[model samples]
Target: MAEGGITVTIDDAEVRAGLARVLAQLGNMAPVMEDIGRTLGNLTEDAFQASGPGWAALRPVTVARRGSAAPILQVSGGLAGSITHGGDATKAWVGASKVYAAAQQFGMPQGYAGRTRRGAPIPWGDIPPRPYLPIQDGGLLPAAQSEVLAILTRALESAVG
Candidate 1:
């Protein structure tokens, strides 16, 4: 289970309408939700593989500390591997269950007073937002939105046929 996560709701009128129609005809949205969850999970994995397409590059200090040019957010692959998705009939969600997932996804500002066990600055420097989920500004990214719309269209067509 995730303490912090992104829930992608279908805000597009056309996609929402198509989904509503399909759900009405199918009489159960669970299957559709499952499909959406799985698709989103895969997309999130792709984001990790791409090292977050639009994310800022790793800082030189971070690279040196890591001892190599390992991708940001992938030092141990825990955050990426912790990604999970699930939904009931009404909603779907995708996110990582890692404790620091929120900080990693949203970023921590510099000069914050938080400290680690050794009394060092929690982040040591600003960690720019590196959104690994296929979402932006509270909605799925354009590509992801298109993929979801395709899924909804297929479901609608199947129900209609």
Candidate 2:
């Protein structure tokens, strides 16, 4: 011992005992450390893409008294279709007569294009009675006046609540 009760010599038994205690503690924390490492690797800058240049820093567009006088479904042949506030967001094979006939010919169940509240279509064997879009005949499907009135009433009640 060169200083106050401090021995700098190698002690084999003490070193082994300290190593065993440290290994036991690390053994319990190995899985937790691996999970934390994986989470840190996922949120890096190169992992996900949010939007293009200058997209995040722009304010959203707002328009009052919104009205567009076109029928909701128009064939742009691409993803450029625009819809205003009152436009029908639900456009699928549900209300199409050709799709209905094809489903019948292939022995598929009727009214397969149903949705949950979040608007995902149900499969062939699993569908509710009501579809997301109600069936329309030859002309354009006009919004029912009664349904609009009911919606307005519900909105007023919700605003009061």
Per-model TM-score versus the true fold = 0.85, 0.16
lDDT of 1 by residue, 1-161 (tens): 65444334446665567678777888778878888888889998998888888788878888888887767788898998899887688866687877667767778777654433354556658888988887766667788778878888888788888
Best by TM-score: 1
Local error of candidate 1 at residue 140 (angstroms): 0.8
* Model 1 TM-score, 2 decimals: 0.85
lDDT of each structure? 0.76, 0.25
Give me the displacement of residue 139 in model 1, in angstroms.
Answer: 0.8
Over 1-161, each residue of candidate 2 has an lDDT whose tens digit, in order, gives 11111111222343234334433444343333333223322221111122211112211221121233221122221111111112111111111223222222122333444322244443324221221121123211233223333333443344445
Clashing pairs in 1: none
